[model samples]
Target chain A: MLITGIKSRPVYDRLAPMASGLRHLAIAQGSGGQPMLRLLADMTPAQRGVATVVYSSESFTGNSYEAELRAVDGIDLRLCASNVEALQVLDDLLSTAKMGTRLYLAGSEGFIGTAMQRATEYGLDRDEILREHAGSFVRRVWCAHCNAYTENVTQRIFRCPGCGLDLVVRDHYSSRLAAFQGVKADGEVPGELPEIEELDT
Target chain B: MTPTAEPTAFTTDETYTPEGAYTFRNSREGVRRLPFPFPDDEYMYSMNLEPHVPAGDGAMRAAFDIDEHYISECHHRAQMLEAMPGVHYLALPHMMEAQWDLLELIFESYARDYPEHFTLTKTGNEWHWQNRLLGIDDTFTFGDPTTLPLEPMEYATRQAQGEFVVLEERDNDLVIGAGMTTQRADYSLRFNLGMRFFEFHGPVPKLHEMGILDRALKFLLRMKPGHPVRRVNWSLTVNPRLETSVETLPEWAPDRATVDAENAGERVYLRIELQPLHRLPRSNAIVFPVRTYLVSLAELVEHAPDWAKRIHRALASLDPELVDYKGFHRYHAAAVAWLAQHDDGAPLATGYPWAEGGIQPGD
Candidate 1:
């Protein structure tokens, strides 16, 4: 069984024992980008042999995470730049899996929901996949006045809760794509396929 | 209250150790003695906060006030003792009870004088109030007076058993190393705070080699500074019966030939060392600030596989209240909610060591 979104320790502690019956484990995390890697680093020598893979969405370049990964004895790490890349990696891993494979999804509600949808599309058994979504990630806006990022789901407004900075969520996906395709921000942009990288394959 | 006039001709007892441990003496009847040996050593002392009492006061009131001040002074003495070298003070339950009484008096006085300035709640024998002056709740609890000695070794063991453990100890008065470990993936690297035990006297060499004594001393020194009344000297060593082991990564060596040639048994034993500092004073204070690393039983179970079942069983075997899922969840949630509401400038600390440099979601 593969578990994603494992941010809590209690959940990992509980799952680790039950995981003995399983062969392959894949941990997917969005924030901090290295939950599985951190777990593996702290694991005893006997525990590290359990074929485990970590898929992180956060950027790991030029960070201690790379050094941490090198320090860990036996674990595979896959860094996905965007949700599309993450889905591609998840699809490839699920495609070659047997019918009884279990996938555990953890993290923000939206991220888990997105993974569940992708898993279903990839023909993974619904019963085999467990979803443990704790909280929703409201759009966080950087407040200039308070010098803190604040998000309020109830208000549905982008204002700093700390210092009341009028903020707007900047859409990075389209802008980054435009820059990648050599299209000026003000120019008429050509429709292009969403860039997808198969990480596991 | 204009500093209630100091009673004239207040007969002060010179025997009252400035460390705040004291023996009560009635002027008319001579010294009132207890059955137990009075701890009059330099490490312990007693003081009388109220030097004089009106001659006509009722016996119950006099006893109650005396009890109150004795308890309060014990805390004061403990704080002072923390400043002395090689001396650490843990409060007994009676002392804590007295401190609570004093707090109650202070709260009552505040409510009576400035009713508009605070909110007060009386539930059974306990009174709850908020310091409107600071816009914060008066959440201090003198629930018990018995102060137990903080044991770091026991704490380390518990932490090794997957329980969250934070150790904030100073190193030779130069560096402060605060370690926080939680069962949470994100908080594994942060320093943790938990109940710990340390033997006062043991093989000093073993203790020094284990580094436990140094950590404990640093922890104590950070909590309490040396003062005139209190003096502390601490020496520690690990129990000889406790076997120690070590781990080394030869794979990360400079060359693969050297790494492959290296024997697996070439690991060095982790020798911890200890030393006694004369000026070190012992203190029992929660040095680590409470941050946002609380997890619910349900969340723990979901994230940590079988952690809920194991912790539930363990806590149930020790204290049944810990197994009450709803109660535990409520307590955990309340702590997180409290943290979210309070805007203390300290960053939200996590136990996950790997999340140190990453841009966290809530950041």
Candidate 2:
């Protein structure tokens, strides 16, 4: 709402080997699935044996790397209809995961964030988890006034379906909320709205 | 902030004595490992600022760190609160939103720091909190107190290493709006709740005259949504109990001030409190988390002879006003002599532990 292409959001890591990891879990969604396949190909045979893949079919552009992911041998792959379901599987996996387990994340900012939220639930430090951002830059926003989550938001300003108020999407992002902030567009001067522009997705 | 660098596990030495299931590891590394509040041997009140845990790790940084003694400390806190039911936890009904804010923040922090042990999830207005460390995973409507086994503040405080107080700012001044502080060094929370900033810290020596509290309040008010500022406060404690606050001052204060030479090292001890003050992002109230630790005077000397000498010098030069305020005037002479006597003829005050190649006495 206040700024554009602020690159102030979290910077992601490229697919690679992480340090001191006894076990590894690679998670992705839709187009993000491609990176998981590449990451698996980079692992040693023994490392591949211990690695697990959690994938979600959800996609903004209808992209899917399912066939390629399934073709990869040795590593285990679990499929889901949505990112939310993938997150559930990740949570269960982390509950039994130990100190030396490493996590790799690739997907939409929203999907990666949702998965990372699960990682945080298991207390994975920065050294223990690496994220590779993929898919669209389209943000998922939470209406500041009504607390309603709007998915796949591509614009800088839009009316919130929850409260019917035109909301200006803020540059800020909350990993805790797993969404961008959407505040009233014309709070200072009622009846006046900010111009609806396309976000730099 | 506690060192985010992963710590090596404790290993016992030859001279170690087992005390109440707590093994005494005679390592200077162990003593230096503790978060000592003083940067210099000479001490004075000032707005000491260090960057609070950076961003995400910062979020996980607790108002109190969970260390090896966490379970016993939690038990001690529970006992303290149970004994003094009136002073343990307090909040005005108007502070409901802030209480919920604090509880949610606690859940978020625990989930981040102990991901293997805790999980917090939200669906609609329903928030589900699972804490393996605390052994309960409950689902409840957000902000509804009746759904939990304990009050939100009490529940959060029980698992914490120390105490937490929330200060609500109004009229450009903060008030002791709510808290679950069962381990106050020497202060009365019951009498201080709702007190303005100036009055709340009135007992702190030289704070007003030196403008430490005023500057600290300004620094605290300037805290942004994500950045948190922290500092360390320290003193001498005569006991190991977590409940050695103002109410129990008489029980131990007399001994701290009047200890004889033979009892000096065994009786008096250093007490350090790692305190972080930051504004809560949602409630806009300030949260003060104090994690307190204690190491005995004799054990400290055994750990590092340089520290013993430095502490002796610091105590000798301590201001008269602060001495009486800290009740150190009671046994400063014996205390200083005991610390110096432990130096064993080494050249005193070469430098700080790190500057002097990390404390050479026990190496």
Candidate 3:
């Protein structure tokens, strides 16, 4: 894999059990279930007793380990059909989460970014969370012209559904917006655009 | 050098319009004070910072400079913000304390330096600010957002002339949490609001590997509350338009194509930002104020021939990646060629390029 040299991109870590944490919340989506299971297996019985898992079946690549995750014993599991529902479950759990809680996130870039945003809302620092990337690198882009977010974007140039302008996705990522930036493709000269190609996904 | 049409008349008392025949060039005082960044005959990225204490002539005399274009730039910023609402100003939930700190800093600076134009009075948190230039006189309780028409940071930035961003230090890293960025070079405040120092500078080439940002961040982290630091960063703009933000690329990006060697003198502009970073007393956040100064290529060649020679060499020696990153790659060749005519390739002095007869430090 070629590293794109995009420093703004969040670095993903491998999921593992932190022995120091008294409570654990593991949130996973799609292909992320494998890492979540691995993390749960690494945890001791006491850690599992205090763990809450939220798994979303949504997968861009159609990979699922929900059954395997459910088969695991001695832990609480909450399953959802979509990533949004899984996020809601995480939110509800985090609202009452204590200081000793350690969060583990596994999924695509967009999933981790949105989950990190929610974690930031409740004043969770980087030390309190560990994120592992699992799925493809389809980007969630924010259109500069119309301020609309288009998710799962794989192409460099696409028409913004919000304002209907042909936008070229810049390699720069915004952790605040939890999305990559997209500006007008032919902004310099109308109807004249640079060559289009697939993103480095 | 070829002769261009003379700029319009400008005076401090009169209303200066940005569209009014380039009034910036006509102000001899302002032209002499232009903070030309190229003291050497070459350009490169570095932590070229200095104490923000008063130094040099006009522009460097104060931490915040309110020049002849102050009113015009403020009016233009208001119009840009209104046209592009919600994109120029943003503050996260935790940045409110820093906002008030920034408001107090600007208010105190302006009132003390330009007493004729601004006055700030405080009596146990009941504050009164008066801006004679904009005819603004209002009273509000300190640290209260509901008392003011706009948020504290936005209110202060609206009256000031340039871009302002507040960076909060956390986990040994500074995060850009709040800003009023109507006049950014080519970035969006909304998108870059929560970025760390190195992350925001990620688009620029070669700065990270060279450890420039690392050193710069270290220097900023050590800045004390009372002491401030300043640096000069330059880029080229198609016109004297202040709103060169990425969101409005469709409007101003096309103007690059309209420039050729013949018209490059009039069309191309040297956009210099006087970035002054100050640590807020209360919030301990660093308030980065980017005070912009624009001089046209023609104005440089016409008024200061020494500047033309130095700029020619600086632009010619610029890294290809930097030229492309500055968004002037389209007209880079034409500009270099046009600036070549004014350069005799002579060596210049080794200090800040102050114009002849301009006041130097300790003069």
Candidate 4:
């Protein structure tokens, strides 16, 4: 009931070559590599030559496409141990990226949304960036009581480790926080709580 | 003042809101959010007014919405302010709360429309404001201006898509108390900051007689804090320029008469607007969000071929008084002819400069 097909959830894009790009950037993490492979395959050799790849191996599923990503390359491919590092390199690339540059993103909801925050900061329009959700739908939750962020949230009702409150994940998603809201689940009644179930996310 | 008493005449209130370097000190961060103000179509202007009533579940989209050009537009405004320090924002000391309210109102609307990109939260006595585009995550007391990293009005304008003006009622008439406007037809906002509503709209004919200005202000005064009212106004410009506030028109106005067949597609533009007025409950100020959209005549011909003839006829239909007021000037004949004959698309035709890559008038 907490997540009845949350309407605020972002509609992910299918990775295809945004042919208008003068330069291309393909950034991915974990199983996000699969979409990157397809994107690279769809790109022409000239496009491939102009493109740059930044891969973050931080995988919740332990899925790595590192070897395959390296194998299919004449482009500059940089490996990052964490998504944060990958995002930092992306910021640097976009800092100087020209008007015609295009961005392709594939990763978890957290990863894709956070990456979009960067693209938006750099003045990249939606037409210039393509984001495809690759992995699980586990959300990032922000506890309203404590302003603490919990990553990889799955259940609709969970105990907030940050403030020890019974948190009910709300359907409303904050792209700025890159997370869903988690408020005291039983705030209305002393002992009453919603059924603890997996989120539809 | 409860906004009930009517004033048929007025005097400029000497009491002005305080603005200083300390209040306006801005950190060089965050992207500007500019909404696409036009839809591709034949253009017309009317008193086309409507209520801010929600269509369903009390979730109605505002007349203005943030679009892709936010960051770039912010850059333009910031650079302009740097180049011309005293041209844009003007405010009275009493309008400070309205400034903060304006920030809260716009950020809350953005958080609703883009739940993913923004978060405006209130916990106990503190409010947390976060903007993903600006990379800002800040917490402050709801009414306390000092808690904010930047001044309330400046922060609000920087994040807003449209250049804004806050009109307050005093002595039975409305006055533009505060604003952060970079674009105006040929008017200097610095000199016009404290002007009455009637004086501000003096050039637009028949509005006062139609009771539009009076009715509109009453509507704004009674409008809910969260709900925003929208209106459209339009004109044809020589090029796709956003900074055409009347003071700067001389730079682009001369180019109009010279616009000929070969370059008309690149030069002539349809400057459309999406104007939204939001009421701040606490301050009783009306924040006007003016979003200007510019689409080239060439691009219009390419998409809406009938638009060429429609506008031509519309131009011809206008009365002499209106023609004299609009002042098409030297480029008038060439523009009309180009619109008439250039309907047949050329093989290598293109879009307006801004339309091609940036946020366009996709409406």
B1-363, model 3: which lDDT tens digit per residue?
111133223233322224443344435556667777876777888888888877654577777887877777777778778877888998998899999999999999989877878999999999999998889999999988999999999999999988999999988899999989988877888899899998898788888889988899999999999899888899998777777788878877888889999999988889988888899989999999999888888778777777877788889889888888888888999999999998887766655754444322211
Docking class of 3: medium
Residue B182, model 2: Cα distance from true site in angstroms: 1.2
Residues A13-104 of candidate 1: C-alpha lDDT, one tens digit per residue = 21222242243445455532345454455556655665455455543122224455556666555656554576678777777766445565
User: Residue by residue across B1-363, what tens digits does model 4's lDDT show?
Assistant: 011122112111211012211111111110111122222322233555555433221112333454444555666677667766666777767788888878877877778766666798999759887877767788888778888776788877777767788888766567888888876654556545656666566555556566788876666656666676666566666654566553344344455555876677667666656677777888877888777655566665555444444455555455444444454544556676777674443222222212344223221
- Please state how well chain A of candidate 4 matches the true chain A, as a TM-score: 0.95
* Cα lDDT computed for each candidate against the true fold: 0.30, 0.70, 0.85, 0.66
In candidate 2, residue B276 scores what lDDT?
A: 70
Which stretch of 10 consecutive residues in model 1 chain A shows the poorest summed lDDT?
A173-182
DockQ of 2: 0.01
**Cα-based lDDT at residue B161, candidate 2:** 68
Error of 4 at B363 (Å): 14
**Interface RMSD for candidate 1 relative to the native interface:** 23.4
The candidate, 2 or 4, that scores higher on lDDT is: 2
Ranking by lDDT: 3, 2, 4, 1
Residue lDDT tens for model 2, B3-77: 455543423121111233233332344465565544456776667677666322222245435554555566666
- Model 3 RMSD in angstroms: 4.6
Give one digit per residue, the lDDT tens place, for model 2 in A135-194.
Answer: 889898877556688988999888899989777776656565567767666653456567
Weakest lDDT window of 10 consecutive positions for candidate 1 chain B: B240-249
